[model samples]
Target: MTRKTKPSTAAAVQMPLKEAEAGKETNCDEDKPSDHPKERDNNVKDNDGTKPAAEWKLPRKKALLQFRCKLEDAIRGDYLLGRSYWSLSRLSRENMSSASSQPLPLMDIRLWGVPLLPSKGHEGTDYVLTKFLKARNYKVGEAFEMLQETLWWRRQHRVDETTGEAPLGPDELVLRTMYVRSVDREGRPLCYHVYGALEDREVYKRALGTKERVEEFKSWAVQFMERVARRLSFKDGGVDSVVQITDLKNMRSRSAKEARGVLRSTFLMVQDHYPELVHRHIILNVPLWYYTFHLLLLRLLHQSDKSKFILARPAKVTKTLLKFIDPEDLPVEYGGLLRENDEEFSNLDKVSEVFVGGNTTKSIRIPIAEAGSTVVWDLTVVGWDVSYKEEFMPEDEGSYRVTLNRSKKLRESVRNSYYINEPGELVITVRNPTFKKKRVLYRTKFKPTVPMYVFFKS
Candidate 1:
């Protein structure tokens, strides 16, 4: 008879799954409508006594686009992409709700259980995922604890370079192993087993050098794991506690296929064995996407010893960098400081341009049928937005000049703030503030559908 262990401290027992699926608004895979001013602000009372939620609703096209954009931003900001351990693509309303709600403690009965889905044949009533195991009077807690202990053992596996034998922990601990075979002098392959143990000083590589040594290692490994399992009240049901096989021979023959099979099996197995724990830890697996840009900057800064650049006043450096890149040919394109007669700028001519606003030009125009709805335009430029989300630039007089088209100037001058929906032609001129003879012009034809946000870093 198995001696049952008490409930696991790591598993929660009481939070029902129903509360995890609420507060979710399902989308039909269609674009969400854009909001009017009041709607965008959650229909709050406007300071100017504008329209209320009952009086304002967003346009279908605008809402859809905005939602799509926000979703995209969320994905990008979170770095939910390739090789991420967290499967953001697997996110659902239930998962999102479960994360937001107050979670129960480990002692709660709901911790080891999962709320059954309506379609899961528990129609009209909620069921715990582990209820079936409970009905069989099996000590699920013991099984769970044993699994955790096994993983902990695996995680702690290490060996000393000099020890030829496995070392034991202070207490009895479980271990796993595999068996493999080798070829004999007659060219006949003889089978042997190998052991993967925690703190096993005898590394398998040296032990498996000969067929006889290999068999000896495998025999010891199987016996060791079996001993641990028996001590933990675990029985070797039918399958072998460990497998024996030649590693290099098998791996080389089917690398790709084996890898795919292992990946698929591991994911499903993890979900089956520890669904709740897996869900909570999934976010940790996600790649830190936003850090990529920051990392790149830091790397470049280190490589160039540009530490002083990052320390400069944000406002000064920000504007300078902005004006530098705001041109058709980036300031960097001029290749740092230029000779008085560089061939690159030989064909370039300076032109007279007016600067009314800051570095950003308000040349785009987007018309809205309603006065309250928010308007935005899409500019495909990568990492060009003025939002602080991007790297900081310097603020300088000679760095960059922004000009607005005549129409946009008229609008912003009258309204103080201009909103555009479509792109309009605008010219940006960069000149040598002192020499004033060497200059470059950048023409932007892209417009933004979203409200453009500009900030001074300093």
Candidate 2:
């Protein structure tokens, strides 16, 4: 067995999936995106927000042209007002509540940031409309109806005016349970839904307290989605969808009632309004009992959404998350080097890995020779159940060694900070006692700190 010293990537996990490397969105199977000269040219200004030409097959293209004409008629006839419409493609509209009690205009319509007037020649027009078309499987009538209903819903609810940071903001419970973290490997925003946070007695009480409170939570949830969506570019080939990570480890069985009653409606409403906006729905740390809950929930979803769902057992949480996100971009809690609001490391810092053979130990040495400097490091071992050691070894053998951790049997990612007064190296060791090889990923950073003596200078 060779000695494991320093950060070596000889044993890094070989990522086999290349889906994240794909450049174009997986459009409907009708036609492949054309490699048009204008689409390829970076200098083309008019098509900045438009999709590639010749993306639709002949029939779908015909249907799309007809759909555009229908949109023009809808704008002129003012049919996109005074009605509450749900996505009847899967679930019924009766389960949803009534439309808003406000008047609205049908003309000058827009979805997210793209104008809906097909005659306007805005490049984003076709791009935005194509999403609705795809959601309806290229059925012109259904897609147009969905578009009209979306516009009606937006105006009747006064979503533009009321869906600001206030008047319907998420409370402490919502903030704890759900949040927007970093981006995935494909640069899609990651929206984390940690239902485990609901186990907090206070959070539980607030989330399931009363019928009215639950309704408020639903409204707040919808607006939160809108806020995130509006920030996304409706432009062609831009990040238009978000990746949702739902963690179910700490959620209680009792809360399944809330999932059925409250979460079900909120989820359906989101699906209705936000068509094709979720690039992926990754559910992590799924417990055994949650399978029953998932089965029941599946009955209420559309086939499109059902296809997007990816479930991971608790044991595969870290591995599954890593498949779609690079280690540097993922969070520390999810077995990656990234730390939310981390001071020592950012997207700029790179993470490397080391491989340990079966029944062997690996030592990672990070040299920091500068005195009066603070070094921070984070690391984790895949399928970690091994003993680890951390110490500071002075460059000069005459100096004594400082032990950070004598030995630790780690199961999750870890981070620490240390200050150096002399030239030394931070050495971390992980022993793989098991019969299989192990992979270790780590990153480090250091910033000079003002020594006490320097501050005392007169």
Candidate 3:
């Protein structure tokens, strides 16, 4: 659901490149003062010979031309032109008239050597293109090159098709830590990722041992981003950005190291490939060591990237979260109203249990008592990582399909509700992959049918 705007036919204003290249030197008499009487008298006479105040004004047409020229000159003089200035200048001038007249062909819209076309159902390619252009300081060639590289990388890894594929057992552990739960007040999707919840180093390394597996993981990451992006709609009142919340509670030294290993690549992918997609990044429960590590990371980011990050400690987490998200949409763990026992969830029934084990897997089969029913679960893990999943085995001959897959390490909880499409066996599995025994708590509920909305006229 990419945002779309009606294309404007107005010509893009062109900046004067020549004047920008050659800096303007203003002659001011205030800078040069002579002590001699003769020089002072001569300066006064010259000033007297200057045009009168009323005569200094030009005709309306001439004045407009002059204003346009000055505007161009100001833009040109403000920023230094880099190596790609010439390419940008030529492209801007050549396309100025045509861009004003009609829509440009998607294939012809080249950013460097890569062709940039609007995604299906998204007609705001030009709008997104402008963002990349601004990010690179309007250097078309440089922006295009960066965009091209990202597109090429995406193609090499088959990022577009990642949503349909299944993650390996081990990879599922990492994927579960990052979750896209719901949307914010402005319709921007809210994504939560717990950095401290990554698996052990050896286990993670083993999971990503091969290059193909590494690419697969990267593809999964991109797919997660695409899921967030797909929720955006730019139809007039629609939002075109996402809000990310990074929870750093219970982070240890080992977790820091693991987080650092993956964060750089993740940041690079987001900044380079998906510029301007993130509206706000709220970091909750930041650790002391995080400041030192964050400072180092800041050196690699653009200044604009630095501004989007909002860091808050435990004391201010609630206030900070409330500023950007409504209380209803915010999770109860972060001092919001969405949780078990809350009014919204009060009507739902619950089945609660606590399991303790190591290197053991637990399975729960929830029989679909009736079609059109709903299955909901809330799971939490303590002290270790757990691989969790949900599958549907059809009563007929169809193959089983995985509805949910994830792995989490932190003490955080996961809640999900699914509407049963067909009468089938709903299987829930949780596996403790670590050597140390860990505690896992879960609550599940099944409804005969999902509730429908009801309204009454006033």
Per-residue lDDT tens digits for candidate 3, residues 1-458, read: 99988432111221221222244322323322112111111111101134321233334223323333332332344322223434544554564464343322322332222223322112233334544544564455566566556655654454543444555235466565677654565556678876545445565565455666566556656777765555444222235557788887776655456455456667677778877677777889887887887888888887767777889986567668867765445665775545644532431234355574778888767777566778776655544367777677667677566566554444346677777767777777778877876555455666666445423433
How many times do residue backbones clash in model 3?
Answer: 2
- Please, what are the lDDT tens digits per residue for candidate 2 over residues 1-458? 98878421211101100111233333323322222111221321111233343443467666767777776665665554423222321132243343542223344556775666665545455666767777787798888777767765765555765675554444666777667877776567788877777777777777767777776766667777777777665555556667888787786676656644655675576667778777778988887777787788789887777777799987777878888888887887888877767767887688889999999988999988678888888888877878999999999899999999889798878888888989989999999999988789888888878777877899
Clashes of 2: 0
Give the TM-score ranking, best first. Answer: 2, 3, 1
- Per-prediction TM-score: 0.16, 0.79, 0.48
Superposed Cα RMSD, model 2? 14.6
lDDT (tens digit, per residue) of candidate 1 on 1-458: 99998542111111211222342323212222211111111222211234421232334223322322332332334431222213322432334344433222221211111111212112111212221222222244333333333323332231111123455221222123332122111111112211123223333334444556544443344343333222210001111111112111112212223222332333333233322111111000112332343354445322212222222121232233233222212222111121223342321332122332335422222223333222221121212222111111113444432333232111000111223332222222221223122222222112233443534433
| Ten-residue stretch with the least lDDT total in model 3 | 38-47
- TM-score-wise, the better of 2 and 3 is 2
Best by lDDT: 2
Model 1 residue 227 distance off true place after TM-score fit, in angstroms: 31
Ten residues in sequence with the least summed lDDT for candidate 2: 11-20
lDDT ranking of the models: 2, 3, 1
Superior by lDDT: candidate 1 or candidate 3: 3
